[model samples]
Target: MRRAVATVLASTLLFAAAGCGGDDSGSATDGGPDKFKVGAIPIVDVAPLHLGIAKGFFSEQGMEIEVVNTTGGAAAVPGVVSGDFTFAFGNVTSLIVAKSQNLPLKAVAEGNSSTGQDGKDFGGVVVPKDSPITSAKDLAGKQVAVNNLKNIGDTTVRASVRKAGGDPAGVKFVEMPFPDMPAAIANHRVDAAWIVEPFFTTAKNQGAKVIASNFVDAAPDLTVAVYFTSEKVLKEKADLVKRFTAAIEKSLQYATDHPDEARAVLSKYTKIDAGVAEKMTLPAWPQKVNTASVQTIADQMQADGLIKDKFDVAQVLP
Candidate 1:
């Protein structure tokens, strides 16, 4: 018998969503039998959620959470909109795009944000160890791989490339999942790959090197992801939402205070390597969702042509 190495698994936003029916008889003041379904990617950004579960944060608040793993936010969004998921984890860019298209979604909490500290690894464009690409400028006339198009990757990478004295318009972006990025870069299938943690650590350990920290450069202290639900869910399940938010805030605080324990929870939930989980750069787990941070992403989407009109960020924040 041979043992095999394990692999890790990883949502989206949509418009015109339905309500995920909840327990109307549930107590709001005390923790009740209110249950909520959540769609999420099994990534480090969601470490706090797992940490909360392990610490019984949600249970203590009288909420039971069912977290479903999806490919990314794009896929997760549909679940959230159709009432299949009461809430979901998604990048702000996708949420903004959905909102721009008239989706009745509201961000209930902040999920993760990039670190502003220098020399700290958050996310970046990674190239083969010996690849000639040195800076974002070297990426001109080359192909790049991003997890999604017209979202965070496209917006930030292009901005960073231009800031590096490169012609971003000259670069082409292809969608590639983060898990496959290391092999893709090694095979020369993609000139470079835009990736985030755990995968970012994996890429580096597998002979890939960072070309530029594009995300932080293009957008610093950005609220990359959020916890969101549809308008119907918000209106119908206000009590559940309130309790969930309070529980999540406690979870975030726990994750912030106990980084190692949070990483351990991430590994347990996602089957990610415990060692890798320990080394990965964790996103900042904010206790509250900052409207200004989210607004920055919306503004960038508009400038990048991902959104047609500028909308008030407050409208989507609960």
Candidate 2:
């Protein structure tokens, strides 16, 4: 059985939230029953959550967490807003867009923040090893595959291309899932693919080289991934939020301190090779959500016309 340690404050938060009639609750403040449900995606960036579960961090916090795997951020947000899950992980852009649309969601904690080290910004445009395209400039009039059009992969690629003195709109963007990116490249169906996670590693293993990483051209502190909860959940279950955040922080500390152990845990959940998990660059663990970092993403989304209105970062953060 996994063992977890909880902070006194977090325990209090859980009780307070539960007492307010949040959901079905049989748990006590001191490790009695399962209480909250957390939804997540399979992306490697959510390593800390997997690590926390493996290490029993949430269990120690007196919370029973239900982990649900969804397609991506687009699907996760609605579940969070509808109270299907108490919390969910999503891209910062998605959160900002939701906020602009007056969704009841707010970010309670930072899930992951990118840095250039170890390919932390592991997303970029890549072509087959033998492709004639040599640079971002060469992508002109070429077809590029993005996991989702106008999403993180595509938006970052567009920014990078523009920074490289290439036309951002020169290349046509094709939508494809990360898992299918390699086949697309191999068939010459697309000149290059913008990808993240297991696909990035897989593509590299298959002789696809990156032309540029988003970190090279985009804002380094841009909010990439985060933990968000609905406003109703926040107002009624502040304690649960605190408990979750505390457990997550502990899990992150453990990951940073015991990388080998963390990688082992990640491999089981992500099915990523142990060696690949070890090689993948992960974002820094934040103690709480950073408002400024989130605002940067919101600003970018507005500029990209992904959101109709600018949202105040503070209002969106718990």
Candidate 3:
């Protein structure tokens, strides 16, 4: 597995380096092809998208691709719906909420799916190693920090608490960006934090003891992330969407086969240290959209009140 991963990574890195000087205009393809502008969040889940670009996957499909980094999942929806991006990497929960409000978005492809391989999917509800709150049930009345209110962090933690036979509503959830989660916990602003990488790795390195992981308590095989395109783009550029999906899939395969190479490429784009990137638990890349997997997400969203009206899972899954 390691050897195969390295070979794929090496090939992708060479491909990416060669494509660097290609056309940047959204108008011209290297081989007189269609132009596209793809957007993604600056999170690890979208690393395969970066890998695709760097590995010349888009170029290989005769596409002139430009990538934009957005603020968060919530912001990505508007950009895609308004045609600011041909496609955007968004969270499944956020997409469901947008669809509930009649956003003109269609999920065109699967990005990365979370797994328990290295603790990558859901974050650990962590407390200082020396703290007395050693379990999920012990967190009652304690303050917990999350990246955002009513987002994945909160939802996952609530589910985890219930799974542990604790009251989901017992803990108070405080909202804070990932960068500040550690400090907030350290300063006693919150008793614990439900955090994702690289904060998950960071918190543990700082002697934080994990009380629970989201995947362990929440539903496994959840569709945490996906690639979404607007109705406008879908109608006018279905071919481009297909090409993009192919390139993305190739990139994902390469990343899965070559973790070290993937980490190196990610470091080039994200500036995260090689060591830290390698140490972090990366998500698994699914080859195709699984309706069953996505249905689980929709079900969770409906239960969380993120989606108001009933949605047919088949209509949403690409």
Q: Write the per-residue lDDT of candidate 2 for residues 45-94, one digit (tens) a residue.
A: 77788888877899888777778886566667666755567788887766
lDDT of 2: 0.69
Q: What CA root-mean-square deviation does each model show from the true structure?
A: 7.0, 8.4, 10.2
Task: Highest TM-score: give the candidate number.
Answer: 1
What C-alpha lDDT, on a 0 to 100 scale, does residue 154 get in candidate 2?
Answer: 62
> Which portions of model 3 miss their true places by more than 4 Å?
1-33, 117-122
Which sections of candidate 2 miss by over 4 Å? 1-31, 117-120
Ten-residue segment with the worst summed lDDT in candidate 2? 1-10
lDDT per model vs. reference: 0.75, 0.69, 0.69
Which sections of candidate 1 miss by over 4 Å?
A: 1-32
lDDT of 1 at 210: 88
Estimate the overall C-alpha local distance difference test score of candidate 3.
0.69
Q: Score every model by TM-score.
A: 0.88, 0.84, 0.83
Lowest lDDT 10-mer window, candidate 3?
Answer: 18-27
